[model samples]
Target chain A: MNLKAVYIHIGWFQMSVTNLIIVIGMVVLFGLALTLPFPGNSKGNKKGKGRK
Target chain B: MSIMQEKEMWTSKLRKSWQKTLPVEKLLPDTQPAYVASWIYLFGVATLASLGVIIASGIVLAFEGASWYHYSNVGHFINSMHFWSVQFFFVFMVVHLWGKFWMAAWRGRRLLTWITGAVAFVASIATAFTGYLIQTNFDSQWISYEAKDGFNSVGIGSRFNVTNFGQMILLHVAFLPIVLGVITMIHVLMVRAKGVVPPIDAFNAELGERK
Candidate 1:
């Protein structure tokens, strides 16, 4: 539908090293949150139950 | 009631009344990071909101038929939203990711959150690549042919067929979203569940003391 996309300037908006850094940063944060156990779990704080 | 049913009832009955279980302050307590950057962290939520729009548009396009966007008025707008939404999705996702990174937000814990998200970010790249091809226009065809050389040169030729609408659409609308969404949802829930790490003042202090 967007034949005009051919004319769109990709180089102007393409992902670059800075964006890569931001993306990697995001991933690292997500990885940390998902991999390591929560700090308060030892206190018997509410854990994931509604997820099921 | 059967024993199992009886047990369920007891859990519900024994469950503390919502009001009594948590004091109002704790229930509505401050969990947001105290020194979270004053500029809007709300942008991440906005990116997510755009993605939500994309999914809705994508579902409609799929229902109309895979190539339906080539024909209908509604389909064109839907495609436009998908196009624009993706642009915004990357924009805010980048910022959101940066915010999390600069805040040293992952310091205290949440490694799984970080890793799953990283995988999803890679998936998004794949999803975007597929989206470019699925456009079914001149740019799509040109991009498909052009990008194939890169894949072929890299020897990943067998895994991806950039020109195939069926393959690209399935990967974009089905496979990649499932992976990204599941990870993102889990990450957000965990953030809410565990709360953000407080500013690393203590860790910095320890380092300062050590120095």
Candidate 2:
């Protein structure tokens, strides 16, 4: 095609590459963080007395 | 409460409630004035005032006809006023955002206000983009086509047409205002609920030493 179309294609490619990379990085980091368990005294069922 | 009861005019209730008790100022206490930073907070009201001017000027421009707004001196003046109001709206909004940001004003139970305001900012930007396109001028032509590429690249082009006056103008005048108004109301209500955040304790300590 023409030089203008080529330039448009190049610009779009660069923008998509940048935006997609950023979005992917954010998602991966978020997923990793989500999978992490919080370090704490895990006392859930321990709080209750046994039923009489 | 019934939906119909909730729909009653606020002032109607205000008049009805006058026999009971006056309103309390501590909906959120005045103790957190420093968080709002005095006169600078007026910038938020100024932004709202400019939005008022925009709507008023826009309605007049619409009444005069779009082509008339382009050529008639009066229409042009009204359009210019609307343009300047948008400038003011943007400036005041930025200042308010900055002032709130530096205060770390979202501390305490007030994070929701900050989040809603951030959403409002996004909506306002969308509103401004539509405002630019609706003029259909040289600037509009360039910005419209150029902006669509960014959208088309991202795959939102199927839903939103950047060049269509019907969509953009309706969005600018109707949809955005309703959303912004609702969000703004929520933002204000949350702020009133949570009260302003306390000033930095270190700053208070410094001031105590000065005394």
Candidate 3:
């Protein structure tokens, strides 16, 4: 049940495989959060809505 | 009028300032702007919730003694919760930071909010580093020695010895958390006062509509 942790190394830069995955996942999540429509939010549906 | 009576009390001045800046309604709002309807807004709350979990788990670990986690199963579980919650906290916080940066959250006179949030992030890193140093293991020993050089280069090594477990634990569990909590509270209050920053386009559009 033991596994050696993998790491990515590029000359002077190094990061654990798990951490690199986490970073990539966070970036993807941020993108989705920006693009995805929020539930029950009809603000985007309304025309001429500018924070009134 | 008597001299002492004529002068306003400092407490009254403080209360007035608080009332003017952040009344109950503003501090705890029932409604938010339509633009706040985004999943990105949840990251800030997620980071807060993760901090709560970390604090709760850490309190349990503290009651059992620091090294008890290495021996007792329950202690180990609690310690694991603390560890994972910290990871989640950092992840959520970093995502929140990224989202805020893209949103230009410091816009509309909210610069203090952004500054406080950034300060909290750095303070959290220091707290986490201290937590690592107090782990009482070879990993901690290695980390301390490796970190000592950096701290020394910054002229803080004498004051903040990474190898000193007692000093590190105190900073980790007490001082850093209090500082981080204060900064976080100020950041949240500023956000509540100013409201969430609108998107750049929406903000410009609002100004255009006004004009």
Candidate 4:
């Protein structure tokens, strides 16, 4: 891969498309990790006993 | 205390502290409370997983030497992996840090865990800075030159010597990573010892008052 395919350019800073994609992908993944409810989420017994 | 009592005191105190703080079941719990299934809870493990990838890729890159990545495709690929892994690690860690902060995970006297994790985040940034400095490229040179004035003004430039390739490489590959790893281990152990913090709502409900 050409690591220098600049996708975003500021005055003295440049970000390659590849790196930008990776960062965007990570953000999406983090969003999903924070918002998505999984199967393990159950409103189980609310007993406060036996917890450490 | 008598001599025998004094001798027993050390061992007895050690064992007692260990048992009370981290019983076997708590250390290796098979079942977590349903609340643990929250997506935010997974970021801690995700950060760890990305760190693992970063370290593994770093080891491979180290064996090939620093400049080899510029010449060899495999080396470049591994280097890219390492770079991306570090990015992912930071992203996940920051999210986890924010999530825990919002949840007040430091509540319930897990202050040490929170402190260690925050320190680990700082150390990780330092490690990444050193890693960038050791890349042996124009970018590294520019970064080092740019960063030297900041360190010098802070009276740390002489000690850290960001421009020194050997020192930077050593810190990037060894010293900083070791410190980061140890802090991370302590953070995880504290989490295991203290158990996951309950949600703020649960905590407030348990206390019978809105906090």
Model 4 in CAPRI terms: which quality?
medium
Per-candidate chain B TM: 0.76, 0.78, 0.92, 0.92
Worst 10 residues of 4 chain B by lDDT: B198-207
Which of the two candidates, 3 or 4, achieves a greater DockQ against the reference? 3
- B94-159: candidate 4 lDDT, tens digit per residue: 889878888899998999999999999999999999999988889999999999999999899979
Candidate number with greatest lDDT: 4
What is the Cα-based TM-score of model 4? 0.85
lDDT tens digits, residue span B18-135, model 3: 8888888778866776677889999999999999999999888878877998888988889889988999999999999999998888988999999999999999999999888877
What ranking emerges by lDDT with the best candidate at the front?
Answer: 4, 3, 2, 1
lDDT of 2 by residue, B1-211 (tens): 7867865979767765642332354343434342333555566677789888988998887777656777789887898998879877876776678667877888876788899988988888888888888886888888888898888888887778887768877888788888988997787766766666666563656667642
* lDDT per residue (tens digit) for residues A1-52 in model 4: 5454657888998887777887787668767877786764466556555754
Supply candidate 1's per-residue lDDT for B198. Answer: 66
Give the docking tier of candidate 3: medium
lDDT of 1 by residue, A1-52 (tens): 4143233237677565545665676566555544454433234344434321
Q: After superposition, how far is residue B198 of candidate 3 from its true place, in Å?
A: 2.5
Q: Which pairs in model 4 have colliding backbones?
A: none
Cα-based lDDT for every prediction: 0.68, 0.70, 0.87, 0.88
Off by over 4 Å in 1: A1-52, B1-33, B202-211
DockQ metric for all predictions: 0.07, 0.02, 0.52, 0.50
Error of 2 at B163 (Å): 1.8
